[model samples]
Target: MASIAVYSVKGGVGKTTLAVNLAWCAATISRRETLLWDLDPANGSGFLLGVEAKKKRAAQSVFTADEAPEKLIRKTAFDNLSLLPADESIRTLGRQLGSIGKKKRLAKLTETLAKDYDRIIFDCPPVLNELSAQVMRAADLVIVPLPPSPLSARAFETVVEEVKGSGRKHPPILPVLSMLDMRRTLHKQAREANPKWPAIPLASAIEQCAVTQQPVGAIAPRSAGARAFAQLWTAIERKLAAKK
Candidate 1:
């Protein structure tokens, strides 16, 4: 199974949104057995999937014992898609990881679930802490979401540097521009400015995660956001296919 982590050095760049939509697209459209692992403390991906994991069982349980992640793997409302929802307790995952001698604990944990899944998508947090390091080591491909802002560009570069310096078997980093509103003058300028940028157009449907409580592709298959997600998924698929 191929593991992909959607991450960023900065927050609010639509990392969780990309994780949710891409996993949904892979499962529903590509017919792949996919698992979305929510590693963010905010648990926004869980909220989008209509699962309440805030006060309940935390992702911390997974590290405490061998069965926590297995038990936490909950099937979503969508077919061929499953979720390892995040609990606020995951905020302490960095501390927990530091206590263990296993440098690749996350990678080993994913191995046990490999047989049951075809693709594992991690909705990673936005820092370079121990937890992020573990996720980076576990991922076969790292998908970094960036905004159109100059600051986002810098943050993207920082993530690239961190991955390069990690000393682990790093994966290919795919950078995507998220939440791009082409209607804005700055957005238009950014696009024209970076002519070779691999971007998906921004749309309101992408933000409907809060209201619809579902991934964009599932709720509005014909929406512009859904079409862009489909195209992004195709590109990702091509990359993975070429690697094989």
Candidate 2:
């Protein structure tokens, strides 16, 4: 199974949205048994899928021998898609990872789940802590969403530098230009500068996913936002194929 992480050093770049929609695409479009693992403390991924995390135990239990991670897996309304929801308890994940002292704990966990899933997407929190390190170690591909801004560009550079400094087997990083507003001159310039980068336009339909509590593809399959996500997923598939 291939593990993909939607991560960013900076927040509010639509990381969770990408993770949710991509997971949906993988499941519905590609017909893969996909798992969306929400590592963000806010649990936005779960919220989007209309699944609340039934946290019967602490977050650490997922990594411990006491509880099997499968026990926490919750089926979503969509077929071939399941969600491993996150809770507020995940805020302490960095500390817990540090205490475990296992550099590839997350990797190992994903490996165990590989038997059941064709694709596992991690909706990671925006932090450069031990948890992020573990995520890098685990992921086959890291998808970074950058909004059209100079600061976002700088943040992407920081993420690249941090990944290089991690000194682990590096995963292929796909930088996507998200929340693109073509009307903005700067956004147009940014897109023109990086013609190869996939972009998700800033559309009301994309934002409405939160209110609809569904992926854009499911809510409005023919909408621009949904098409953008589909194209992004197609690009991701090509990248993964080329890697193999």
Candidate 3:
């Protein structure tokens, strides 16, 4: 199975949105047995996907104590898409992980679920703390959603440096531009200036996720945003397949 983390140091860069939509595409469109694991305490992925995730058992339970992966994983409304929900208790996960050596905790937990999933996408917390380090260690590919701004670029650099610093045989870092409005001059210029930027346009349909509570592709498959997400999933699949 391929483990992917949708992560960003800066919050509100559309990381959760990318995680939800991409996992949906991977499961529904690509037919992969995908699991979207919410590691963020905020529960943004759960909210966006319309999964309340109010269960007493959570992802942190698997790490804080000992719990089987199947015991914690909850099936979502979509076929082939399951969720390992996050409870508010996750706020203390960093502390718990610290006690167990952050680098290996997440990797070890994920190793248990590898046989059950073809793709596991972590909707990670927005910090470079112990928890983030653990996510990096566990992930096969890290997708960083970057807004088109100078600070975002700098943050992107930091993410690259962090993965490189890990010195793992395989470091997962895939950067994608998110929430881009082509109508805005800055967004247009940023795209033009950086010809190689994998910029996913900010489409009206994507923004409608707040009201629709569904994946962009499911809400409006022919929309521009849906197409962009589909293309992004294709890129991700190719990258993972090439590794195998």
Best-fitting candidate, scored by TM-score: 2
Provide the TM-score for each candidate, comma-separated. Answer: 0.94, 0.97, 0.94
- Between candidates 1 and 2, which one is better according to lDDT? 2
Q: Which lDDT tens digits does candidate 1 get at residues 10-129?
A: 988888889999999889988889999998888888888897653375688787674557677888899999988887788878888888866788898899899889999999988788
| Tens-place lDDT digits, model 3, residues 1-244 | 9899998888889998899999999999989899999998888878887887646636677886566667767788899999888878888888788887645877877887888889999999888778887787888888999888888988889888777766656565778989998788887887887766566788789988878788999989999989999989988988887877
Among residues 3 or more apart in sequence or in different chains, the pairs in candidate 2 whose N, CA or C atoms overlap within 3 Å are none
Residue 160, candidate 1: C-alpha displacement in angstroms: 0.2
Off by over 4 Å in 2: none
lDDT of each: 0.84, 0.91, 0.84
- Given candidate 1, what's the lDDT at residue 46? 84
Query: How much does candidate 1 score in TM-score?
Result: 0.94
Write one digit per residue (lDDT tens) for candidate 2, span 34-105: 999999988899899999866743556787556788988999999999999888777888988798887788
Candidate 1 deviant stretches above 4 angstroms: 54-57
- Regions of candidate 3 where Cα sits further than 4 Å from its true position: none
Candidate 3 residue pairs that clash:
none
